[model samples]
Target: MSTDPRLFIDAPLSASAAIPLAREDAHYLINVMRRGEGDVVRVFNGRDGEWSAVIAHASRKGAGLTVADQTRPQQGVPDLWLMFAPVRRSKTELIVEKATELGAAVIAPVVTERTQSDRIKFERLQAITKEAAEQTERLDLPELRTSEKLAAVLDNWPDDRLLIFCDESGDEADAAWGGARGRGQPMAAALAGAGDRPAAILIGPEGGFSPAERDRLRSLQHVVPVTLGPRILRAETAAIAALTIWQSTCGDWR
Candidate 1:
């Protein structure tokens, strides 16, 4: 059988040194996994990379580990970002988890005019992303940005980065309008030319972008509005779908 999946705990780790894992983590390893002394596990911090560790001690309160050896080099993710309006709590968690799995370099919540939810618990969301990355064997965790106004985000948009806005309204047009203008070429071809330049996929709120918001986004020079087919998709679904498309087109999917 494959080795047990490693976890991302808060404790610091050094090669050949012992570190005490948190009480919560200890319960998971000792109680949940039923692991005991001398059992091997893996651990990683976003900074130190991945390491093989052995369970030095386990108790109901916590667990301890001895860092053994570095198992892999730190991984580098693509320069893609997932910018979306925050949905419900469950869906928000889903987005964070799936975005990490899809290799999003950053997770940004953009507050649009029609946004329903304004409050976001950053700590909880970060934990979800970290867990997802550890389970998926991703050495890097996507940087989670605080919620920013849509207009503010547009104003601060980097000149070199391309914004792929998923525009549902573009489907009715006979010809490609907005970002779809140059989409005649295959996605792979378009992405190949993008090089290391940063790219972002913009997903709107549940109610979708307002007409004024659409107009403003379309007017931006860096924004490239693309269609996610003819169907109207929910905000969370659209985020995953758009990210998947981008990854397949220009990311590490190959």
Candidate 2:
């Protein structure tokens, strides 16, 4: 494991150059971590890849760091996207955090008729993603798109990206119809055999997807309706469950 501390900031960094870290970051490093000058850290931009750096100056307001060398090149992410109807604020944040940790290439919010929360705090969600990436040692942040209507999302579905729709309508008697088993083979096993095509998992709202929405999703060739389980799961639980299955099957869980 790399000993360098991971920090996410928006400032530009260049080799052997000093860049001022953000105030919040500086506090976290100095006041929080009690680190002083010359301590090593790792940084990454969604665009510039990852780099090794050392603290040059520390202050109460902020700190400055000098880039030492590039550590890892930007890595290619999985072709998986996570789309879900917005739920409550705290759970929504959890979903974003877990999705990032699970290696979702994109995090999209789809507004369905049953969606409980129409508004999302983008900044808060972004912060959750950043924190998750930092802790999980991920170099890239998932692309977060604004919420769109479910109908609109279906209308613009990419032809090649398979949509794994988590539905609740399957027969309880069938093992395949309930829980993670129906979601497909374990995420790791599925991804090992999967080609380069991108895929997405769609999670509905608290009240679940409307019957019409389910029918529409089933009708789409790109959408594959699958069940999470026989027992009803909360919106947030379903999102995490689906993501866990996908990551374990086809993403970084392996």
Candidate 3:
């Protein structure tokens, strides 16, 4: 990666195009980073490929840049989405950040029966994803959707898209986490048969999925219940682990 600062611009990018920076972006580049006139910076707009831009002017009011040339053509991650029930504030932010870094094309927060934190700071999460994409050199930011009920999300799920449910609980009625009986198939094992289908990974909240939620998910023909491992994982960890599995098995990691 180049030492120059990278930013996610919202303007069209092309050679010689003069793009004005947003207020916050101007503050960041000019005041915070101390970048001045003629300083080189990297930029992307999710539409255009990465570009090399030179700072046109830097002042207290704002800053602007002139596109020098395209550095890389536009590219995108595989068609993978991550649907996770929001947890605590910090953990939820962690989930979104890692999901972006792990190449999730979309990140959604789902409300499940056992979900504790149904509310979310949408703009804050968006900022998190944008910063993650910038630092990770992703050409586009992941589509961060608003929080929705898991049932509603499932009801409208596309038939062609595979939904991988990370089910940590088992069918054991007498043991912790419902025992180990009738647990979902291991993640890698289940994904081995999944091929390269467009897919999404669903992770439940800290309490895992309610029995009814689990049953409904298992009954869906398009939903594949897969275990992360014998041990239970936090919502954020499960999101990261599941994305890694999918990417390695059927996504760009190959």
Backbone collisions counted per model: 0, 9, 0
Measured against the true structure, the TM-scores of the candidates, in listed sequence, are 0.88, 0.87, 0.94
Query: Relative to the true structure, how large is the alpha-carbon lDDT of every model?
Result: 0.80, 0.79, 0.88
For model 1, residues 45-158, the per-residue Cα lDDT tens digits are: 777778899999776556789999888866778899999989888898899899999999999998999889978999999988877887788877889999999999998889
Best by TM-score: 3
Distance from true location, Cα of 236 in model 1, Å: 1.5
Candidate 3 lands at a TM-score of 0.94
The model with the greatest lDDT is 3
**Which residue pairs in candidate 3 have backbone atoms (N, alpha carbon, C) closer than 3 angstroms, thus clashing?**
none
- Which residue segments of model 1 deviate by more than 4 Å? 10-12, 170-192
How well does candidate 1 match the true structure, expressed as C-alpha RMSD?
3.0
Writing each residue's lDDT as its tens digit, candidate 3 over 45-120 gives: 9988999999998776778999999999999999999999999999999999999999999999999999988889
